[model samples]
Target chain A: MDILLALVVAVLLVVGGLFALLAAIGIVRLPDVYTRMHAASKAGTVGSSLMLVAAGLHSGEFATFARAFAGVVFFILTAPVAAHLVAKAAHQAGYRLSRGAVCDDMRDKAKN
Target chain B: MPSAEEKRQRTGLVLPTGFAGLWLLLFCLWLIFNSSLALPILATGVVAATALAWIFTTRSTVWHYVRLTPRTLYHFLAYTGVFFVELVKANVNMLRYVYSPRIDIRPGIVKIRMRLRSPIGRLALANSIALTPGSLVMDVEDDALYVHWLDVRTTDIDEASEMIAGPFEKHLGRVFG
Candidate 1:
């Protein structure tokens, strides 16, 4: 049981770390802020949340797990709202999409 | 407008009805955060929960609408399942996009309409789409939501709405709408 639990923790930590790494790589590699927001909000949230759950599970206590789960809940609920606000602000501030983007339907609506 | 005394009486009437449940929730949250049942903590938790619940009841009518029926509970669970599945799929897609040798994505903004009536329901829909990979909600105006699609597969409003916010809408509608 101890070994199995350790293995689970190790996997969660590694996977979580990999996701965070990917999110960082994405932030550097992506063409524009919007795409970067996607990386940060989606992968980044999962990364931190998984690590939190792993830390909780390592303790092997229900209260610790519940608190960690609450953290996860808070992360998911807020990440998107933050991302949406940033995206809206960027758009409002006239930070247009990179040249790689093919379409922007909001362009006309945003103007008038 | 009502007089100050009338307003006070009205608020007093509203406070007690919603006070207990909110206080219980807040007290439970306090216990979880403290991770203890010590006497001092319990005493403080009770006081803090009561104070916060009283203030909240006096200031807002939002929590009063939250009905805790079994159907809502069931829908909330269903929404959680949908959310986890989407979260996994989101990361898998992100892994592919982030790890690919040369990035090729047709990113664009598309319009989608929300059917949920309540502001909370619409907010939930927006968050669900934004959390999922390949889509981020940029703005919500009236019944319309503008989403930044990482890969612009379709531009039709109805099609995009069905594809992006479809799964969450049904479950959140039951809970919040």
Candidate 2:
């Protein structure tokens, strides 16, 4: 049972670490600010949450679970708010989506 | 000018009382979980948790509604379960690509509209998008969400919307709306 628990922890940690790395690469390599934000927000939120869960599993205690649960809740609540704020700021600064993009709602608003 | 009763309702919860209540709750929780709390320490813990919960929960007028219902409880559980599964899957996939030497990645931004109307729903949607792998939400305006993607696996906006909007917005609509 302990071995099984350890295996689970190892898997979670490895997976969480990998996602964090993906998020970083996406942030660095993505062509534009908008794209980079996408990478960071999606990858980062999931990565951190997984890491928290892994920590909780490894600890295998109620207190650890509660703390990890709190972290997960906080991550869920804050990540999107931060992303929305960033995107809103970027859009206000006149960051245009790539051309040949089929629909342009923000552009249309500018026309009106 | 204000009536005494109105004032009583408004300022009824003084700081000390509030903190004491919070501390009490925490002490109780500690006792329940830890299975041992001496009287003096329990008193101290009670005072602390109550104070903290009061200060923490009362931080913003943004949280206007406090009512809970069966539907809301259901929504909460559903949201947690879905988010947990997605979080695990995204983490595993992200690790694989990141560790790979070739680093096969295609990145871009996609703008899409959200169906959620309430501030809470919009917030939840944005957060969920950010939480998922391969996507990040950069902005939300009215009904729209501007997202950045680590990979443009498909250009179909509908598909992307389905991936995002289905689980989260449905629950948000139930909770906030």
Per DockQ, the best of the predicted structures is 1
TM-score of each: 0.91, 0.67
lDDT of 1 by residue, A80-107 (tens): 9999999999999999998978678789
* TM-score for chain A, candidates 1 onward in order: 0.97, 0.91
Give the per-residue lDDT of model 2 (tens digit) for B43-161: 76666676666775467432333225698879978987887787666666666655567766665556676776666556666677676666667656666676666666655668877
For model 2, the docking class works out as: acceptable
TM-score of chain B of 1: 0.85
TM-score of 2: 0.67
Model 1 vs truth, CA RMSD: 3.1
lDDT of each: 0.88, 0.67
Off by over 4 Å in 1: B1-12, B16-21
Taking the tens digit of each residue's C-alpha lDDT, what string does model 2 give over A25-67? 9777655666556566667776788899999888888777777
